[model samples]
Target: MAEENGAAQPQVKMQVLAQFIRDLSFENNVALKGLTGTEMQPEVQVGVNLDAKARSQPNTFEVNAKFKVTSVNKVNGDTLFLCELDYGGIFLIEGVPQEQLHPFLLIECPRLMFPYIRRIISDVTHDGGFPPLNIDNVDFLALYRQEIARRQAAAQAVAN
Candidate 1:
């Protein structure tokens, strides 16, 4: 519970109104080109980006998580596959202080949507003719901190 003007604040409430895939693309390079090696060893890399914006409806916001996944053959450095996904969720949030809203949208919202994002990635990779790739869970808190630090650095550079 939070205190406002010496009065206890109401409990925060958040609801995911909806979730959808804004965009998705998957390319299997191995299928395009014949496999050169007898054994396939893939090195996968995933990148994540987040964005949030307020909607016209009061207390409603949209949060988007963008993921870019690339896999390459560890031995030959040949590209195996690439997947890019943009997933968005609409949320109705209330009772949270205005000062905490930004972080709530960027961090908590994406954390909630991560499992679905992971599932989509796995399904796409499996259906694309390769083994299912289950990616590791993301650290949204660390990612948020890094982005904040990056913005601060950019601002400092511009000021200098």
Candidate 2:
């Protein structure tokens, strides 16, 4: 049976739908080092955080996928560059399968967001005078698993 509303209501079916970084950017501040030949064995630290938000309008959602990249020289511990990207997208999802939603939200969404994030990071690094740092392809499934494991471990520890 269809609702009285003119808009056709889709049958609730399970399907995976995802959106990812259509773009990405990186800003390397160590551009001068390449030209100056300043040798620095830097330690790199990378972190990522994923978040979701509901839009004011109906059936609209926003996902924020963030990556933090920091480089520091091990010798003197001088910070070389700190890059943070808040990449996100707004999507409309309805009638998607429950089984597929996790992949859609975790994997697909990040993939769509990646390109924009990559561009941003590259531009920032180039403008900062460092060689462009192109991020490698991310395995969202693996990342999601790791995140879940970490969270579960933390929760368990807290409970204990």
Candidate 3:
């Protein structure tokens, strides 16, 4: 809360009301047999997606960060394990201008939620009898820019 020019303003409030694992799935496809104890190191494939949507309440939104990791024995191409996680947070944002809303929601909000989600991924894998997979830092600004360009291209194509 702030006061300026004899008026009260929303003070650019941003808060995370709650965060949780919306969905999670992990598969250890094969027993710990040939998956390990071999000369070849298993390759891990990771996929990531981020999404945000407005909630019914004003200034509230849902932000989702999704991750998928698959492990494969390189030599045999055999599946070792797979894990998919959808993590989300409920956020409250106020007093931001409309022009800044998209980036704020997509980039900033998810930026705040990523660490907790990453830890969940690591813990799930470690408990499943594999090494904890520490995720790398993400560039949210670049991601947001790409998404904006993609949406604009789609709109331009539709306009034509």
Best by TM-score: 1
The TM-score measured for candidate 2 stands at 0.70
After superposition, which runs of candidate 2 have C-alpha atoms over 4 Å from their true positions? 1-38, 99-103
Per-residue lDDT tens digits for candidate 1, residues 88-129, read 999999998999999999999999999999999999999999
**C-alpha lDDT score of every prediction, in listed order:** 0.94, 0.70, 0.86
Give a tens-digit lDDT track for model 3, residues 1-160: 3465677754688999999999999987666454446555589888778888999998899999888989888987888889999999999999988888878988998889889978998999899888898878778898888888998999999999
* Pairs that clash in candidate 1: none
**Per-residue accuracy of model 2 over 44-144 as CA lDDT, tens digit each:** 77777877665786556677888888878787776788887777777776676556665567776777777777777777776776667777777878888
User: In candidate 2, where is summed lDDT lowest over 10 consecutive residues?
Assistant: 13-22
Per-prediction TM-score:
0.94, 0.70, 0.82
TM-score ranking from best to worst? 1, 3, 2
- Clashing residue pairs in candidate 3 are none
TM-score for candidate 1, please give it.
Answer: 0.94
